[model samples]
Target: MKLMKDEIETRRTFAIISHPDAGKTTLTEKLLLFGGAIREAGTVKGRKNSKHAMSDWMEIEKQRGISVTSSVLEFQYDGYHVNILDTPGHEDFSEDTYRTLTAADSATMLIDAAKGVEAQTKKLFKVCKMRGIPIFTFMNKLDRQGRDPFELMEELENLLGIRSYPVGWPIGMGQSFKAVYDRHHKKLELYNPDNPKDIDIISLSGPDDPKLDEVINDEGLVAQFREELELLDVAGDDFDVDLIARGELTPIFFGSAISSFGVQTFLQHFLSLSPAPTVRESTIGPIDPKTREAFSGFIFKVQANMNAKHRDRVAFLRITSGRFKRGMSVKHVRTNKPLKLSQPTQFLAQNRSIVEEACAGDIIGLFDPGTFRIGDTLVEGEAFEFDEMPHFSPEHFAAITVKEALKHKSYEKGLQQLTEEGAIQLFRTYNKYVEQQIVGVVGVLQFEVLEHRLKGEYNVDIQLERQPFSFARWIDGPSKALATLKEKQRNLVTDREGRLVALFENEFQMRTAQDKYPELTFYENSFYKKSII
Candidate 1:
């Protein structure tokens, strides 16, 4: 079946985002099931740290029960081919999320019913908004204890400054949670968790049943919904309340992912209304290397997987303009290096297959081509220059010391391979001991994955100790002078925050400096402390 409708010319790609453990993984599994991409949803808790959970691929991630990396899953939905970037929710893995957000046209911000907006959720949402991507809120886990949808909706509005309307309400929550009625379909679907096949649908639009009205009235929710309906009618399809006001069609659906309660209904609504990728205002560029005048594709990330004798390194790219074909050579704007494509592959979780060609608005993986790096642009012309890849300065740094360090040659080779995958940052200072830092968006799960890959793949057991008086200091002078000063001050004090505060001399700078800096001492106390030391 065609993934997109005949009339729909654009593709729709959405990224699922949430705080860690907000059931983002569960939602991804359900969507895959609805599309028949997977026969059964994998339970994250039951699987080995490395094997089962679709998103939790790294060994440490599995053992620690966190998502350390991002995974892309493409499937056909409604009339559009939807590519869902399931991203990691932890802070440590936020860099991955940031990069993935750039790859998506739209975002589905997931919130836990029990835990409304979290730190990671807030962080990723900002990235999406900054990119001007339209977002839809998915308030999940109604069956679990925590905040309710109404509260979450308000929090989202206040915290994120986004205007959203709830498309569905929970039928029941906690223990009595069962199913939800589609606001659009007006049909109630009862959930049968033990036997998912036993789904029952009922229309509640024109029913005169006393029992139904009684339940609605008792909850004081019917009047609320009627008000909502009136407001929606006033709001209209143009998304402007004063203009067309065609009435609100953002139907909300409810479901329990574990029991597959409202999975089918959610999928049906998602397919019916979610816009395709082509409808999105995509960035355009040329593909020809010589004319570099045209739009080209940008590679966001790369992953290496051992399949057979031919191990594959996949480069995930978004076409800004032009078309890319298999076996074509394109120049990377960043490195001034040309990469020959073996094939272009699209992802379904961990599985990837070759595609004939890719056009603008497509996000697919290009197969093994050496000399590829994240944020590299694939352009046709040699002279054309595209924008640099989005900058992500690592905020958190954990210096790892190997308990059983590898041989020098092995260590160098392994670190090179690891850094190329954007896993960690390794630094050597003459004064500070040699250290390997796992730097990126951080989450508990992300760190776990780094640990696993380092130990299992790199054959190194390591301990991470906070660096002594860490500060990313830059002198407001020449590079030579700064380097000299850095060397002099490298071991002066363990007060990184104070050092930075002294440099910036701003309140915001001091506040942020203290929050992130582990060891801090006020400059005023420096003299007294120096004398005491």
Candidate 2:
């Protein structure tokens, strides 16, 4: 009981978000390196003989050297149980990234030194801001020749509409990159990339210490470093924990993730300052982590065949209240059924170990035999659903065709499992399931992954014919009202659950259909928030 509350206080669940190639995976590996989760860090993109990143466990991810799906990684550091959600940096997989954000209490926004704020960075940051989560900014790739730190800070305020306070500022960047000066400690931590773990710190009287000149050797570089530090001291925003908690101000740290410089410093400060497991919103209202006694949680992600040999599905559940113990029977709120949570495991990417118990803010994977879903709430005492996750209006659609008609079993199995995992939505032209299957996704890259996975995993090769349609709307209200609108709308499809969807080729067509069928309610978002029960 008391131990549960203490454990909850020490939990910090967060997600790392950034644009493609901004070093999100590299930063994630470095954090794991500091946490002692892995023996040595691996590169995001490696040679044929070299090892790929641990977080990117998928074969396609290994081949492309990019994270197209979010993976959960947990580790312990300095009395804190940290759960790191490594999300996809590619915009094509932004929908999966967005859903993962719902489970996180805070976010770590990684920014490239050269490209200040990118299109995908802006998009993910907007989602964080919308969720009102505290964001910690890390200016990565300082080992490479990049933009001025001051310019990057200004761009953050001007473009992202957020202020920043640098806790550790870089002494130099690119090949001349030396180290990060700890502003709070008034110490210059020397960068020793040769043996990064053997860190050396010099306690300075101040930034103007003459001893620094001898250590740096470069007089001009020392002068510029002191000047920048002086300007930042006098004019920078004051460090405010309250503002950071409110997502208004971000505490920025400068370092190169690949070199493993300034990572431990960042991790230490982040744990002490970042928010822990907090109150969760539910249908019954706020569920406080400390006060609620009954074990309850919600499924934010369900992935299939994480362990290829097992052929199983794992549901990633974020415990909202109380503690979960292995083999406990709990109410599956969606189905109004009871379930024995016998096999609960914690993760280091695909590798897993059975966990005896887990508390709030902890993510545990339940061996789900196709019984769990995203946003399904499980509870011990009472039943209530968490707020529904968004089902974005698809911007792209394609008709799927299996290469071998004889392999219908494998093809059907692949399509059903993928759709169930929320990777993509399946739709048909009529009420019949056999009618041309149209798959809709938030981005185009998903189509590629879909094709790749079906062939790779299920032994079913597929060809996707692109559709002319751009958007889909779920129909509501009178069926008769859709009669006239359906005549004008050539493509009226039925979604997986048999909901009528009017596929529009353009916004003009959507507007025209709306004007024609004023009585019918057309919802752009296809949200099935309610359960069958």
Candidate 3:
């Protein structure tokens, strides 16, 4: 089957990546406003009277003023069905951000004018580069005094190994910020902070339009702006669509996310330039987005306790091809069984509505009753699977147990749900009779989140005892070798999936074990091998 060209061209999906405090959430709110998805834009930092951002729906995010989990939002703008993946900017949750990127067709890189490119941005950019996804740069917070435009462009090239092509140029900085000069259209867009949504567009016959002089009363500023524009035209990289599509060059736009300046222009140009959903790689081969074959998609994220009142879980899926309808039955590629998807929902942050139908490039959530996991594939025809998603190795370890015997059931249930959600990894001692559990995480903040959720959502408290181990490896070998190794190693355990593992205090300890047990093999990630059904 083949999809109509018009239907395929109307869809766009991308993710936003940025560093902490870089106004990523603010940009998301403003984009939603332009799309008519929301009537009033909400601040990321919730106020007594103002609503919080639609994308940061978690209670923990509202309380902490930072996104801790990835959120998928879909809306309509300019006759395009846009799917936005808003990722966590905090370095503590880089794993979540990495997983979210796997589902995006392209990425928007947000850089603060004050801070050129922070540590987290570099890490995120490396992932995008590795995937060879096209990236668009938005220099945010131009209303504040920041680095020179030339310097910022130079930094992007020097650090990220990518060329920058300025699609628009700023007139001035901070309080003196007046307007942006559109290089492509050769026009000036006058800024109005008091009414940022109302932009006054003026055509520029040339740099010496008398109307420009009237709008820019500051003679000195106008002269300086003209000189900069001339310099940029002469020295900047030419706007090459081929280079941008290849991820070799990024078009730059300057704006203030809070005041909505330059946001609408950026949105319009982005929609016209960005690519629609392309091809996805699977075990069978590459799956084309334009194909109208039986529906197929994979789960990249599994969230539990989305509705705390109901204690529900939702698995987020990105449709790769064909159309999806409510009450459709799809084969679970891993389990080799058919599942009737009865309640597929679309997200407006935490507020969700049932989706009657969706198509390729769209993201929708399916209700999961402990039957789904990240990386599970749903298909309607012959069985096939996508490439396995990366499972990050945990760097921190801890021993944990419930504080009270009476709360053991609730504690166990909470632990199982959270682990299944990929918040943390759970392991047990090889001695099956032992009741204590060991946990591993990429960061220390996960421990705090686990404690908060256990007490707040499950009515159970936990006691965490820090462990000296800094690394863990899953063991693979014969039963006799495993027994002999466990007998010699003091730190040996088994994961919830019943896989044998060993904990090491540091790199040296892990090396010693590898040398002593030459017959055994070790795996840093449990999902290293692909087992297709």
Candidate 4:
């Protein structure tokens, strides 16, 4: 089975990751603008006369001006199909971002020119590195005063252990900011802050082009930029296209996303350098994106209630190979059952519409009515499964009880839906059938989101009581050992799926269990050899 070159080469799927307030959302809007996805770019913090960012559609997000979940946006630009995964920069939602990264073939790491690499950026970078995905660096907010370019490069190398190659260089810092020298094309892109959509492009014969001084306007700045360019060319490591594809080296671009300076230049260069949809690993073998085989994809995310008018749950599937068409019958690998995908849709964040057709590297949303789970694989006829999606261990625990006993049904349904979405983990005590249930989450902020959604979506108000347990481990052993552990441990509980687990008061208690019950195996996080559920 073979696909047309145009079909294969025109698709580009990537993710954007950064620390909070690094202008990541702004950069996404500007890219969409270049792609003609939107008529006018919307600011994240909507002004009195401006619209809110399209990607941040949730009501809470619009008010808070932060992305809490990952968004998938598809648009066409210059004869290519671009799929951008705009991920949350907030550290509390890092788990969601981690799952989203698994679906991307490449990543754009945004760094605040003034703050450099921060904690969340490092964590997200590690996930990208683990997948060996190519990363392109964008030093954002160059319009503001920031650290020297030389210092920023050094920090990237030392902190990430990856070599940096500057593709473009900024002329000046802060108010003096003017333009960027495009090293790849030997061109100058002059910035026009007032009319960012219109840029002045000047071609240079070489670094010594005499017209450079005239274009630069400032004679002193021209000489300084020329000297730095000369030094960088002579001393910097040679650009290796292969290394950049292997995630060993990052091509850096300087830009101001808010003002849209240098964004188009970065987008053009990024598409040229980034790899297209590649092969994915499966139980059978590597599935080539160009193979004209049957359609196959896996669920990376399950979002509930994208539309308030209807109680809908959407399962986001990243097509790994072949083509997808509406009303096609495919096998649900996990359940070993065939399902007719009647309503496949494409996303513009929360807003979506039915799509007639899609192909590999495209992210499609399927209408799920309590059937789909994260990491479920779908195929036309193949009987193989992809690698399991990883789940992070939760550090915080709490017991939740509905304030109004009459709303218990709604509370239960909401909890089940949210837990299935991986918003939080649900657990019940084995000692007694209590009305209150325990929940675990990677970060404490998740509790707030859980409460907010329960009240707003389910119309059920709940009270959350913080728990002291710091560690949870899934326990497995013979019936004798299980019974003995359950009798001795007051903190024993079962998850939503009825998996046996033991909660420890502290690290000391966990160690004591390990020492006492040598026959039982304790797992820090639940993982499947084949299916995620």
What is the lDDT, from 0 to 100, of the residue 182 in candidate 4?
Answer: 91
Name the TM-score of candidate 3. 0.96
Error of 3 at 269 (Å): 1.2
Off by over 4 Å in 4: 1-5, 46-49, 193-195, 433-435, 528-533
- How would you encode candidate 1's per-residue C-alpha lDDT over 54-157 as one tens digit per residue? 65555565666667678888777655566778888777777777877777766777777777789888888788777666566666766665566556667766
True-vs-predicted CA distance for residue 337, candidate 3, Å? 0.4
lDDT of each: 0.58, 0.89, 0.88, 0.88
Candidate 1 deviant stretches above 4 angstroms: 1-10, 48-51, 193-197, 204-253, 271-275, 278-295, 305-312, 368-370, 382-387, 395-406, 430-448, 461-465, 469-480, 483-487, 491-533
- How do the residues 406-475 of candidate 3 rate in per-residue lDDT, one tens digit apiece? 9999999899888888889999887756756999998888888889889988999999999998888988
Per-prediction TM-score, please?
A: 0.76, 0.97, 0.96, 0.97
Off by over 4 Å in 2: 193-198, 431-434, 483-488, 528-533
Residue 279 lDDT (model 4) = 88
Task: Give every collision pair in model 3.
Answer: none
Q: Which ten residues in a row have the lowest lDDT in candidate 4?
A: 524-533
Compared with the true structure, the alpha-carbon lDDT of candidate 3 equals 0.88
Each prediction's Cα RMSD?
Answer: 8.2, 1.7, 2.0, 1.8
